[model samples]
Target: MNYALFIARKIYNGGDNTQKVSKPAINIATIGVAIGLAVMIISVCVVLGFKHSIRDKIVGFGSHITVANFLTLQSSEQYPIVINDSLTKELKTIPGVKHIQRYAYTQGILKTNSDFLGVVLKGVGPDFDSTFIHNNMVEGVIPRFSDTENQQNIVISKTIADKLKLKVGQRLFAYFINKQNVRTRKFTIAGIYSTNMKQFDAQVCFTDLYTAKKLNGWEADQYSGAEILVNDFLQLDPISYDVLSKVKNKVDHYGETYSSENIIEQNPQIFSWLDLMDMNVWIILALMIAVAGVTMISGLLIIILERTQMIGILKALGSRNKQIRHIFLWFATFIIGRGLIIGNIIGFGIIFLQKWTGLIKLDPQTYYVSTVPVEINISLIVALNLATLLICVLVLIAPSYLISHIHPAKSMHYE
Candidate 1:
């Protein structure tokens, strides 16, 4: 906008407010806009932060991708799992690949004291990623590879341990149904770990790969599918595609094309629920931006109304209409930009505070965590900034158009 026109617009918008709208009204309007913007921005950041944080937890516990046996049975019976270890070794060379471990998990019953619970007994080799539960261990130790024959040791979840009143070095009997559907063998309690997700922690128990092999009666070379731990969880889609190129000689589950997914796909419903939350966050974000933009538009219109007479004088004094629009544009945009900055400050401040202090609480029984998790998506914030700014500019078109219709002759001669 032209500098002179902009100044003219501002003066006209102000309209000698001293004699018209009292300073109190202007203050209220400014404060109202500030509050609305702050609320919207903060709401968006908080909700999105929670969604992203939960996803990272899921990824850290499980990898970005897994290669497991396809569900071929329709009778609701467990299927036999086997993977091509040669193909797994070849797939590990793909870029962004980190580590691959063969795993076999089966539903088993563990008996400890007065309690009996079902758990996913994971049979893993020495190469398993210990970091997943390294920090999450709240009691006992992690599942150590048994060094002796007939070791019969296992790691249980904290939830299970508490319910059963069992501790480390206690004997826990595990019952596994073989391919023949016969109960065979028992595992001892060597360690206990918790991921804090009761849904997961309560059900996941761990043991060595050799034990799973003995139970399944598979040959030395046969085992269940592989869990592919990646350098980054976000690389799942791209790496999964590359995986198809390498694992063609092996089993193909998706239309004869090996797309990544494993026996661990049992938790699809939980993940689907998580994805729903992601969509909810985005929808809330869109609504917030709209609410903030709408409130600012109302403020600008109020400012425009109070300046009608000044707009007339400027128009009569030979100032072009386009220049007149700039003054109001600058005023409204400046206010919005200021509010945006303030909102971001408060939003991120709250996130850090909650992260350190855990001031916000949620019911772990219902929410899976004791406090809200905050994970800022920088790209999301940037997109929100641009989007809100653009909406403000576009909505400004309405009241600003009122500039062209201002009749200076009648205004200077009349009120």
Candidate 2:
């Protein structure tokens, strides 16, 4: 049986009243740790939540990656590329590839009685993933696509619809600017969606791929580009390279020569803004850890002072300095454990509450999300707990050494 652990538990449980320190000081330290941990947890939730929310909006507007002819560099222009069965099969085989869909965009203007808006008419094939659009649809239904029959349905953003005074089932005229002259088509408003991204929402309108092909004067087998979705956004770089290499290898037979562009590389400015959040998170984490460390240090010092008489008694009994240190360290560990447990409960409680109720509101213009978002990563929580425990224990060790300096005669006689 380990006597140090046994004695430490006894003191912690207050079964041995003589070994105890002032309750108030220990309570204050524990509260300090709880507050620090709570702040850290909330900060982590907001930062990661904001990062992912912005990323999903961008990906929804574009895609995780784009496979297109090298000439189709800008969103406004398109050079038709055929994504044949062989090319699709090869792309699917690449690890982490989620969904592939044909997409094409043309520059156009929407004209209503009251107003007009310059919009990019983005054409999507039947296989288009509409999950993001459905989630963010403020009103009406997504434009339905039929392979055999032409569907002239269009999905516009509330930002555009409101400005143009357009409504669902309303027939509007969209004029496309071509090199030769101008082309006009009648389109029905099928839906209104809002991604809360002002720039993307203002500039884009969705329609069927057939309409885009007809507008571009392309054949049935051709598409401006293929949008590729990946299972993991973090693995974009490797997956993009793998996809590019696979496409290159198949180009000999399939005649599917294409270049891949990662979502990050495509919109460098917005991603750069997201990257800045990491620095802010790191700074918050360091500050919280420092605060917790200082609180633990103060608590350990008090515990030592309160037990100076016991330290002397133990020393006189021939207890080694290391063994006595273990006793105090164990006591400090108990205090930290209590703080962490209570802190986790309080912190997670707030997180869950906000997640369910959305009690916190954010400015959509500034944050790109109406509600304050949160993400609870189990691995991150575990790492945080371990790091805090380890750092606090290490910090207490320096103060624990003061036990060795308490001379047996001086401590015993004075107290």
Candidate 3:
């Protein structure tokens, strides 16, 4: 009963070979669609993967949110704040708050006989979640920290290690200037990790909280700040606001006011750079879609012209212009559908290959990742396919009008 689709199928199946000229245009159009879609898919996946990887790396160094003293926020100095059990309990009550742990910082210098490096000794208590550091460890295991004892074990980054020619299990003396009094402590490196983030890797080293507290001359129950982890990063702002409400204007035992800031606020430069990648992806997508649509339109016009005799015969047999238009539209759909299938195969093949084998590599120093990252979002892929198909078909509608303008008598004579 659907004569348009029936005719479209017969023509698509090469029922008529007289339109040999159109074959080349059709193939070019399909190739154009396939390549454009593949490029779009690859662009989206790469950008998203880059964003996710970089965000995690930053968050791993500093948690989702930081609650520190107002003075500490102003200056990176470890101004003491008291995080008692009661305060911890109150913060844990806030929705989306996953974990809370005490942290402190002391700027010091690591010295060996061969080289010396400036570093920040980040002190974490027994409650510190070592998952992030553990995952990135290259040389040794993350040492266990205890609140009762000053464990002189520390974790250093590979960048610092390579720079200073230091290794895990090596004894290094760290010197800190406290109130113009130079103090020294000997620590054994327990682990070496690399996140490929030069900012953190070159400067930050992890040590037990007690050791950092002693270095800062702080008493028990005193810390520089608390790092808050949230269940979902999307809820970070709301959770940070909730935390600020609990601690804002409230003084610790030392009379220090608490200030809360999310990871994005702490590192604006890096996040802003990451945000720019989205713009790049949008531009790529727009250009690729335009290229594909143009090709499809051209191919549709050629196919309509080549089938002029068929159009005339159908019109003479009492077929309407609308019905004839549907015939070519259906034919265009078939071509577009075939291109989509090929594009999806090619796109996903590259994505999976890179993801599994890391066949393509990037400079860690610049990209913050060793290999090209790709994230396959099924929903996004499906949406892209649907949108591409719809847009190409819609663009071909005007060209399909050429079929309507073909006079039956004239088209019958169209060679």
Candidate 4:
């Protein structure tokens, strides 16, 4: 008979005594392992969700790299916002340069009869990339500047619409200062959109480049500034640095500061809050694993003690010490492996249920995009399983040591 198989079979049935003291501890061990595996899988999926979601949203609004002049929107004086065809061609050749755009923005008020809404008005030239924004738009078009040529067509947001009781083709008065520094004419609301972002949905509006220039009384060729988009977002810092090398005197508007005065730099509280939560998740995982390891260790120890006679019997029958160790290890391995499989299935099922049904709810204002997002990284799952299996198998070493100490004559007669 294969001792490993026989020992495993014995252990599986050994915990059947209902009133036995050892049975409770063995039960706790299984529960601990199940809980640990579940927690690890869920934690990994959630964190991965957060990292990917935030990164996509940010990089969507602002490209990987941004370039601008020292003075911004209202303060900047006498500049060329347009990327001359020559500069555009040269910039396109730069590595990681996916698309380049010239964009201008101004803060203005939208008056609808009795109500007035303060909004940041953005204008983009024909070369502007709308792919990202267009795909994310929940309603309305990106506004075609081709036919009207700045003829009072603007896109407003849903929040602004609700506040102002405005809609497409309804004229909403937008007032701003012209280049001549005089109060400008009001623009007409031609279309409306919602980007699913509260901050932008409520306070931002858009039109084409010619429209902003016409309202500002500037030359047909002028603009406020340009926005550069990159191929990949990971190289954001490096690309920002390289572009700034050419325009050393220029200040970036989108994500402009390398200084402590910058909003992100000054108010680190947001990122700190996320990092703290991340730490908590990690700590929770570590504690769960420790709980599992301790409980499993206890169970193994109990098995080793109860089977002292059997280990000695196997040895007296000319069995190798290593074989005696394997006898118990086979049992432990089967137990842990079964728990791992079941735990993963249960955890993944819960995640899928929550994802499909949205059984879990969160405040949209706090979580940004609403609903809990989940991301599954297959590689991460594989790595976690491998680590757990290795660590648990190594831990069996301590329990297996019991075999060498079991002398045949002494253990067989002791009981």
Off by over 4 Å in 1: 1-29, 71-85, 146-152, 177-190, 232-235, 248-266, 413-415
Q: After best superposition, candidate 1 residue 301: deviation in angstroms?
A: 2.5
Count clashing residue pairs per candidate: 2, 0, 0, 4
- Tens digits of per-residue lDDT for model 3 on 346-393? 999899999999999999999999999999899999999999999999
lDDT of 1 by residue, 110-211 (tens): 776677877777777777787767766776777566312345778787788888888887776777775597665666677777656766777887788778
318 Cα displacement, candidate 1 (Å) = 1.6
- Cα lDDT computed for each candidate against the true fold: 0.67, 0.85, 0.89, 0.67
lDDT of 2 by residue, 131-209 (tens): 9999999899986675345588899999998898888889999898888779998999999999899998998999988
TM-score of each: 0.83, 0.95, 0.96, 0.80
Best candidate (score: lDDT): 3
- In model 4, which range of ten residues has the least summed lDDT? 257-266
Q: Model 4: runs farther than 4 Å from truth? A: 1-28, 73-82, 145-148, 185-191, 216-222, 249-277, 320-322, 413-415
Cand. 1 TM to true fold: 0.83
Clashes of 2: 0
Ranking by TM-score: 3, 2, 1, 4
Please report the TM-score between candidate 4 and the true structure. 0.80
User: lDDT (0-100) at residue 208 of candidate 1?
Assistant: 82
